[model samples]
Target: MEQKVFIKYFSGTMSRGTRGIVFLLAIALLAICAQNTQARVTLENGVKSKVYLSPKIALHQGSVANKYYYDMEFPKGHIAIKSFNAEVVDEEGNPVSLKETYLHHWVAARYYQRKGIKEPKHYGNLGFQQSDHIPAGNAGVCNSASGLSQFFGLGSETRKTSTHVPDPYGIEVGNPLEIPSGYEEKWLLNVHAIDTRGVVDAMGCTECRCSLYNVTVDEYGQPFKPNYAGGLYCCYDETQCKVKNGLESVKRNVYMKYTVTWVDWSESIIPVKIYIFDVTDSWQYTGIHDCLIEFDVEQSTTNECMDTRRSKSSFPIAGDVVYGVAHLHSGGIGSALYGEDGRVICSSRAIYGEGNEAGDESGYIVGMTTCYPKPGSIKIANGEVLTLESNYSSQKSHIGVMGLFYILVAESSTTLGSPVQIHQESKVPIFFWGVAAFGLAIFAAIVVAYRRRRQNGDGYHSIAT
Candidate 1:
């Protein structure tokens, strides 16, 4: 009835040309509204983002807080994670400088707990080896026994590093089909931070030097080998590093502020398997994938002062590498991964900061370059041997240094061609084109109506003259 009323008024009072222009304008308006609705739906279907803070950590001058919290708050339900970024923050939500509190590392791992079982209060350094808890670690390369099985992790470089999983690909988690019966999925967060304020040797503390920490035993109360000097074993929870004399100890609280971006799981989202390669892996000779988490680089006697380490491991399965990044300590120069045929798969270099701010603390590694190769451009054949090389400066002795390469691989069976792929490849959104078309239609209608009116006025003026 409203349409009839609008047509009756326009048909009686408007010229045919004006009526046609009005109809075009109305159609354009409807098109814009439809586009707006579709854009909202697209965002709803695409990705969701949220920021969360972990439980508060208490620390005094030169103290270390390396605690693991089970069942941390994470996005619940089945989803494909696109990215995870984190940083240290004080109580007022302000960014904390790395110069003050050194973020040794933060690791996020997945696990499954029995439906009716309650987890224990203490989860000692042994990890989730209990019967009721099942650790769901990364895809492979490092054995679970090595404790480098986290799905996501970073140290001081966490602030500037890019962990985004590109379009059509994501780190899949929490799928109902993958969960065992009577067990539910949960996330575990391990934050290892060192309070370096007023410390005698800031660099030594961050490097976990045993002399500065004054410890001759590991976290498990086991005696350290004679050659073991500095590493994670020396700076376990509650351990203290050397602090300046007469500096009153002041306690403060801090938290790990992290942001997570993910999308609801769907058939179109291709799953990527995470593989972390360590330069210290001794799988070739030992016939066991024993990965020494950290190693020291002694100062060279010769002039070169460059320590180079390499390891070779076979790819478990054939797949396309979607993303790659390297994890290196402060003294690391750079690292790279080479295929069996000597092709460079990825090379990541540590980015050192030169400022005194939080993310740009001078002399600290703020970030590492990342790799997002074109889909299918970098492929790993089944059982292909790959070489990893990590370089560090040996001008000064460095302890607890690590060289880890993290990569995301998608199986060959997952096709890259999809409707989502086209959308992702486009630099601009479809709704923007719709908006431009709508604006053009309005402008065209106004010009057409103005010319018609001008023509009618000219005809009347000629008659009057």
Candidate 2:
């Protein structure tokens, strides 16, 4: 006869109170771990993981007169770029635009990568201050709201998911667009002319002060030796800037350049993507007028002459916001992001240069540094309304000003949830503790109920049996 085998069964179920306690503690532990994790997630091995790209070029006066090109040449290797950015600067190294130079057109195109892809085509537009259907790749000279005319250059910031202030000129990377090996890429710059001399002459006010004329530049797009004026005036009047005056000077020898930043893959690292948010999409912006507007907030005056209107637009994606910066012309105060519920997610303050330095003229703004505070992560649901708000000085109207904000967004790997008030308070830990306490309370209630039933005699004893 065949030998028989016996097996034991675990029929006892865990008490509801025990289950609740375990679940709560697990959640609390997971939530804490999420905070320590990085914004990027995962990288492959055997590849050059310690990769970063710092491509920079100088735009001389003669070269930028029409369209100048930078044929990006990389050394022999298996290289790729995950992010790219560009900026323009003056000869003095301060963030500034050439007096008459308004970037007419700019394109970063790639040579054919695959056989069927046709001739070299533009992968992105790196022009100054454009928020069209196409993504923005250019980080114009000294993107700030303080109205300081200078180049603050580029800087790198720590990657974070919390809601903190951002530096506009800070060297930050955006969504990854790779330029694989054997593929050629180039940047083209095209600028037009706006005559400040004519604008001042049309004003015909010997006593009237204008920014465009006060900050004067020579035919070579070089500023005068002594620029006593508070601002750079490229045109004498608004009409000259518009309508494309044939008399305006286009041939100016000025210095401009583009700065590109990205992460090089040499080691394993978490991967993140970038997304853009623009305020020009709203009805408030009319292509009929310049992308930059001048406005007087104190007088509440808004017209073609004064741009007292606030720029507001919706954020496109629903993810944890990792990094961000605001792009504004002179006379800006700060930029903020608001939720559909009217809650402010993160506010980036604009920093201005001071002490009457070359770039930091008295009250003029030179740079706007960004912030990346820890613990406070901001998350928005898909299709949620995230408005970009830029505030500027209202004492006087400004011209050729801009208000654009860009951010990096990442997908969360866990459901630990997002944290709020990290800038002011560390709420993640507190939140976990609170959840755990609630779970403990439930467990206690169950225990008390069971004990009461057990002490109740006949019916309780029968149930137990």
Candidate 3:
């Protein structure tokens, strides 16, 4: 009986030792798994980000620079773009205030240029008509010739806007299969800036009032209609706004400092198509989308002081909306996109600056709100009639105002799948998790065995006593 008790006690001690070792081994395995999970996630989500400066722009008091920079330095090779943000900066990389230099608008366009051909002297004129140049614009409902074909564009509100494409969805570009033979992909940047320092009317200059610039003809020397008061035509390159008499200001060089974020294209990444809607779209009347990019807001005639414009058009394709945002100029109150059943899909309001800093320049639009709907919640059916409504405070007449909506759509939600599926596809390698779970199972089994051995040892001691 004493020998039996000794054997039982020995077994209990061995079991306890085994349990402690198993517990430590389990903890160590979990730590290694956590490290492995992090490393795996870093590898799978290989998002690369970089900031680049555009070709230098020279400006002075009341001067304007509306230049198209072709073959601008950009990320090379096939990739999925995640976000693009830009701000005007001086030569020293300091952010420039909108009060000093108003950013009218900046457009980023994609194109294909045939190899062994000289680049066009001006992309705005040749556009897609030149034999050597092919405009690779967004999935559009607007006429490409109307200058609304850009994949990305923003006005003074660029600084505060959110352009990030969420996880698993991206803007796919630079695919070799899509590029035409003997042609290479290229990008174009159009920056229209107006220096308002010492100007007679800063807001008028920014609005491109023809009187402020003292111009009757456009950049191409084309005559403007007698009633055409102001717009982009009045604020072309080399044009100058009326300045204060004898007010001296030195010329300064500035650049559009742009940052791009993207990830290398992979099978797991779902591509999204970009579509831009214009409130001035006349599709129902013209049978073709004629997007008048700008319009004039006449002052109120009575007590009502709001100018509201609405346009309805059928969505050309069926897809799920991933993200949306509006591009509205100064004086814009808000804008909204509606579905066929009058459901509000998305709405964005302007955020005006109240200070004198670069992003917070007083009385200037610093940023606009954005929309990110659930993966499959907001779906646009093919041929679905959509309405766009834009409102502006009509306290006084304003020209060159814009109301545009941009949205990114995915073909289907299957690619994104359920949240659990997205996690499984993007990160959390099955093999590693399986190993961790196996380790836990073994640890649990050892615990149970230790408890049984202890109970048996206790019974044997009781009998011996």
Candidate 4:
């Protein structure tokens, strides 16, 4: 409980507006720490995972792991946070082990800081900070198991074994998953819960279960056509411009699933939370017939994007359809074309094949969600939302990137119908239509009066002559 409070409070200060998902992360970390210090969580698999002290702080779980799952850009060839489990499981369900001594360590995969059109063409490096063994075994694997142990940096034996990985768990796609400043896509997230590394390594129930969440960003960094007039779009090349350009930060949910389990513990449980965000205008097209003109949202509603990088949605539109692309971190895998009523019509997953690794595509936006329009309804009515979900998180998925997108669900009212052209001529307002109608009527009456007067005058002139 105290840990949760600490994170929430700290997050309030550290996070900038709701924009700081780091606040949520801080909350999660606090919960994690609390679970380690003062609580017990029991699971269905008979493995009881918990924090060991006062007031039992944190959600119960033999399931649900959110903090573990991450959705970030993964550089090509990098081995990242696949999965991690922390729990103590003897043959019997026991939250507390009378004779087990524990040691914990924190491990992370670090990437090289380099700039490129997409994610780097290579994987980065990883290292584990170690810890000294626990001096006392009086309490449950609460604070000690989850927090103290890891912060000290204990190393693992499984991490050393590269030759014999019995089960391959992770979305292993080729190339790198990219997410620059403006890249945007619907995002999903998850976290893994690990309590006892020893038992997880021993039991071989290595596949971990996790929690999920969601997030929505304003836009993908793929710049729109340069506005030579304002010089705002030119910042893509300058790199030094101070103008803010990362899309609107909008996190809405978080999801959970499983990753890796080289631990030896019995089946365990975990509790986690999730967060997700959306980029409201993500559905627009960028480059096809022309770059400036956006393909109608109506087309996007019906035809899902095929071949995200090399392909597009040809909605049988009037003009040639153009293309616009976006990206998100790893946790954004399950993104798809959902209807206004929340019915998913087409999806990026189906086009790319469900659960395809984000790192597989060479040209697709990095960390991008692979979604498409559903078959039945491609067009969206007002008040509809696209839920991008999937891919549990890990340390590897945390590098900041872009997020969820929208395709002009509705534009600003003041700037509404003003465009290059309209459905027929111009989008004159309702009042404009009324005024034009009145003017036409007055002009017609004047013309009628002139014709009658002229006819009378002609008759009189003829009689006088």
Candidate 5:
């Protein structure tokens, strides 16, 4: 009997030990899983896409066109835009008029600097230097990302009905317009609006250069300030500038949708910087169109439209230029880019809508064509000035308008990393592991409690006998 009892006891002890071993193994696995979950995130290779839009702005009487900037927010890391699209719509998702109504232009860009530095310097007002005056209330945001000047002419110069880009991204597949670290985590979006109502030649007056006004009287003849600083009108006569008080009221909203496709880089890569130079930088706005120089087609007179080179400014750029393009409006003949010593670099010509088409309306001047240079073909050295010779027709009277906007794209030469990339990479791993460790500890505690209960049950059974 004792031998049988001894055997039974031995078997029970072995079974308990085995059960303990199995439980311990499970706990260890749970611990590892918990640790891994806490340590790193499981990632999948794919593209990330999102949509953003500007605030809906109302267009009222005497409003011709308006311009404003929107700062786009994005995650940190190397951000490359694979696809981009912009359009105007009503509340019902229907398209607005392409002839009279337009999203004149929308520019997408980040900040750029030539000299390498540990931290980015506050870019003074976008369109001004340190000595320039900033509107009293506007001084706080003058030259920073929130300031309008840095991205002044960085986007489309003329009106765009719409833009849709398909896969195999330009620059490189999976590669996008990178927003470098240390720079603002925002993309500047410039928006323009136009409305041509109550004008006699809203459609067919071949010669019309609209005059934009600020703080104009509304259709009710009451003075009102628009959402933006100015508005566009097909003003042939100075008398048309006055608000027609009894005219039928018209209201429209400027709506925009921007789609950005990007790749979440496994590791951060060098970013691409965008540089913009507007010919207006050299010319001042006098509010009179005819007084400025012109390229006369009728009298066969042309003006040598020369301005100080952009390189003459403190704007610094290093490294090879990957892509370059120009923005021109109606009456623009073409633009010539020049390096130091008057050597012509490249010329981007304008293509007008000859016959009456949808975008190429009969009377109105339509869009300007853009150009792209071969990768690495154009290189601007530090302190080098680039002169933009812009050509516009003297045959038609055009508003004191823009000439060529030379946009150059290059790799970041600055040392500061994108804050987005640093934040994303540093925190994710720590968070994952921390959570996993907590889970493993909880699981271990449960196992220990169960074992204690089993031992108590055995003792209770022995006493009950």
Candidate 6:
């Protein structure tokens, strides 16, 4: 566009080149007029769904850089923006405001499992039934994240949909290395973030931070970080965080080894927890330990960063293989592995992202899924604090859904003004008249008659680019 202006302006000054300059101006005017005829939808900055309180919503972010990648900073009341290409019409056939609206995204979802617990009843019908009362596999169902897929949905307070897109960086995992004494090697992770139609606000964004610990190098490709996020919050502090530019830095130098707590063990039980939603009937998560499963680790490494094996992988007591699930929260994006001992292991770097909102809008994207020594030998621990985080740049709070709308507007028009306010509807008639006049000018310059799109409605019927 700038080059075109230069040509039109400079060439017009010369006498002999005046005709060519006029021709270029005429072409530009026709293009301008043609766009005005089709221009309609206007994308805004920030527009997203609100935080759902009832029934709870869960957000899971794992691994900021490597598989354990996690490096996102989120504040309360942050909005998300998503863009699409379409027109929205209301029930009365009226176009609602296209500007993006500010929305908040948060996570709090409930899991329902059935556990059988014999409560003190009037008739004394309380007993552990293995052959008759409860069903099979009731003893192995401790995790229920996949079951909550039905209740997944985002909401909007107003009757408007987003038409803006923010730059998003995606991560993919690859290749595993296993060693007996220690593990060492650099792994590869790929990332791609698309540019938004508007200027993206990536404030307070740090590189994806991750840590690898409680590692076990028991089997090839089967190495597990028993505890996700380097044994939860125990081995982590503010000082452990490192920042760099771009997403690839998130996955470098990711490995762990430890000898502390020589054995790793975990269990998850849906012990009969009754919710008195009603008087006669009650809702429960598990049917009396029906979802009870546990996994145990026998060997692990003790060396922190340099060692790839968790010292605990060599569990002292040769504990039985107990399998249960660990959490993959929204803000935290990464993978977990079980050490040869009974400990948990995680990546060394955190997952970093640049967006208006974190995983709330994306809704707890999956981090990692690996098979332990035995597929069903792992178990989730009891009374664990919910630590899933969608950590991102502090910009998430300020950008809001309005920012996405702004991006959409940018994508819609090359000349979209700084303070993007769409042309008024009534002025559209005058806009069309001007377009026709410009088209006639182009026709004169090019020595060709311009066909009226309103009458022909044929080719070249495109909206503003």
Model 3 residue 47 CA deviation in Å: 1.0
How many residue pairs clash per model?
0, 47, 0, 125, 19, 143
Task: Name model 2 segments beyond 4 Å from true.
Answer: 1-254, 257-263, 283-316, 355-358, 373-376, 413-465
Model 5 per-residue lDDT tens digits across residues 346-424: 6666555545444455433454444445545656676566676677665544443455344434543633233323223
> Candidate 2 vs candidate 6: which has greater lDDT?
2
Ten-residue segment with the worst summed lDDT in candidate 1?
Answer: 419-428
Candidate 3 global lDDT = 0.86
Which segments of model 3 are wrong by more than 4 Å? 1-45, 121-125, 418-465
Q: List the global CA lDDT of all models.
A: 0.87, 0.38, 0.86, 0.25, 0.44, 0.23
The best candidate by lDDT is: 1
Predicted candidate 1 versus true structure: per-residue lDDT over 109-183, tens digit per residue: 998898898765774453676778898899889888888889899999999999999988989998999998989
Give the Å error, residue 107, model 2.
8.7
Candidate 4 or 2, higher lDDT: 2
lDDT of 6 by residue, 30-69 (tens): 6775675444322223222121111111111121211111
lDDT of 4 by residue, 107-200 (tens): 2222222232243222211111211111221111112222211210111111111211111112122213432233222111112222222232
Winner by TM-score: 1
Tens-place lDDT per residue, model 2, 209-308, is 2342333563345764452332223432221222124543443233333333233332233333444334443423442212332222332355433333
What's the lDDT for residue 2 in model 6?
Answer: 100
* TM-score: model 6 vs. ground truth: 0.17
- lDDT value for model 1: 0.87
Better of 1 and 2 by lDDT: 1
Per-residue lDDT tens digits for candidate 3, residues 320-389, read 8999999988899989999999998899999999998899987888999999998879989999999999
Question: Model 6, residue 121: what's the lDDT?
Answer: 29
**TM-score of candidate 1 versus the correct structure, residues matched by position:** 0.81
Instruction: Give TM per candidate.
Output: 0.81, 0.43, 0.80, 0.18, 0.51, 0.17
Show the lowest summed lDDT stretch of 10 residues, model 6: 400-409
Ranking by lDDT: 1, 3, 5, 2, 4, 6
